[model samples]
Target: MNIASKIFNSHSKEDGDFFLAMTRILGFKPRKLGVYKKAFLHRSVNKRDKKGNPLNYERLEFLGDAMLGTIISKHLYTEVPAGDEGYLTKMRSKIVSRKHLNELGKDLNLIEHVESKIPKAHFGDNIHGNVFEALIGAIYLDRGYTYCEKFIHDRVIVPYVDIEQLEGKVISYKSLVIEWCQKQKYSFEYEVYEDTGNDPVKHFGVKLYINGKVMAKARATSKKKAEEKASKRAFYALQDRISKN
Candidate 1:
């Protein structure tokens, strides 16, 4: 085969593989493969359209996030007729939390499809969720809202969502600890500082103090993560009292 023919054949095989994979994931044939292509396109790839607009999954992630919230909110509203706005919102939040979304993405092995200049091993946990949302956006554009909702219902609601379980799930330990402290009229502080341990990566250490005593200590690559880790440890330590409050 000529060089041009070889290039065409290679592109054809890649497209065929992507189409089959998407079909299996979506449980339906995709009408347009181009939109799905953008779902896995990372900003690091530096692709642009004819109008010089950047083409990446970031915008699709935004759209998919909105879709997930709307669909999940509707489901919560319908299922929990007696639930107040606050209750419904909290349930919805639990269902669509970043941690939950990341789990969904990872379970589907979505990271394998991402096109990026950065190494896959260097990518963060959020990348999984980001591509998952982008795929939802692509579904919406390629098919429509009905298809998008169906995909979410199949992948998220049917397999994972359980109202009773979600009710007890903690989306943010830091928020819970802070709420408990405020309710009990106790002063709480997260003392965070750089603690570059012996590791090559910079780390932050956090001391979570409640009522002037150090409740828990933890460290992570970011101050927010360090604080949350400390808060989680404190929550377990004070679970008896915190649960009562």
Candidate 2:
């Protein structure tokens, strides 16, 4: 073979190996391997292309996010024809919530292929979902929308999207409580303060108030968690009214 052909062959073989590895994870052969590689590459690697632009999965993640939103929105629109804009949007958000996506990534063990300088253990739970989204982004870029949609259907919708179950799934209790309060024209606030108690870890306490009435109280390691816990309690307390509305 000529020099150029020999080099091409070597590169192709390497790409083939990557494709095989991804196939084992994805349960199907990918039409384009470059996207999967980009998905797994962590920003810490500091890789750059010949054009001097930094190369990582962040850009792909953005694309993947858009694609996922579009597909889920379409699914919701068709499945729940009676749902208005707000209802559909909230349903879509729940499906693509960070917690749900993180769980999906963990279930697939997508982090196993991440190329990062940092130790894997040091990485937070969000990394798995981030990589998974980046992979979707890559798939869209390499194989076009059709293949990307197919991959999402196979990996996400088929396995996870249950319309009835999702309707009751609470993506964010705090957000829900806040929305309900606003809709009902009730003043609501989450009072968060440093919690110094006998505990191994630092904690924050939250008191949820609705129209000057204390609805619920809770504590957690972080302000967000504290708020969520408080909101969850508030939800249960006002479950009857919330359900009616």
Candidate 3:
């Protein structure tokens, strides 16, 4: 009933700090702190349970991803009664897009609580989204689906879901180019190779070919990013014709 009682009931001072941190983030006290604790644990620590099974946030991330998709789907279904299947699916993808999730995680400063042996700066951008999803997983485990849904609605949808703005958002330019190529009955290819540039990070170079003609070229730190960058350039180059589709 009281703060001291709540702390004594679950865990001591450490959990006390976690409790306050979670309260600030979730606007409510967590019933079970174990799940929440595991949610932020990175695999680098190599911890195992009594049964020798590995412990980390990855499994929780999977559960939270499913939960997030379900809640977002429900909201989209209710908000746009006239939306067809394709429209609704696209809308949901935009809402749960990795870029948006990363932004949400950063807003909550979720990384500050992560228990990783590696320096926080070295962690990839996806860490933010991963921990956020893990947090959702913990909420579901601790409080069940109702609370999980409430948390998503309160923290995610209510503040951020603007249907009009999201409709125009670009989740992946590569997908757009492929879709256009398909509709036009044109063949396309992405030739990716290791970048020879002097950049410190290993870079990838991509050349986008549409109808057997080189349309655009780009380089990035990853093949996917390089391809996407090339595709984005290709999209703009053919925007006039593509928009007619």
Q: Compare the candidates by TM-score and give the number of the best one.
A: 3
Q: Which candidate is the best by lDDT?
A: 3
Cα TM-score of candidate 3: 0.67
Residue-wise lDDT of candidate 2 within 1-245, one digit each (tens)? 84334534767766656665676666566765666888999999999999999989899999999999998898889989999999999989988999988977876678877889999999999997888888888878877888778888877887567676578767778888999899989999899999948642356899998999899999865687789778978987899775788
**Clash count, predicted structure 3:** 0
Candidate 1, 91: how far from true, in Å? 0.8
Give the alpha carbon lDDT tens digit for every residue of 1-245 in model 1: 84334534766878877877787778888878889999999999999999999999999999999998999998898999999999999888888888888877876778888999999999999998899999999999999999999999988897567685577766678998999899989999999999976643457899998999999999865677678779878988898665788
lDDT of each: 0.86, 0.81, 0.87
Taking all chains together, each candidate's TM-score versus the true structure is 0.65, 0.63, 0.67
Off by over 4 Å in 3: 4-10, 169-245
Model 1: ten consecutive residues of lowest lDDT: 2-11
Tell me the tens digit of each residue's lDDT in model 3 across 1-245: 99846796767788888887887788778878889989999999888999999999999999999999999999999999999999999989988889989977876788989999999999999999999999999999999999999999987997568685577777678999999999999999999999857543356899999999999999865677678779878988898665787
lDDT of 3: 0.87
Q: Relative to the unseen true structure, what is the C-alpha lDDT of residue 206 in candidate 1, on a scale of 0 to 100? A: 96
Q: Considering summed lDDT, which 10 consecutive residues are worst modelled in model 3?
A: 195-204
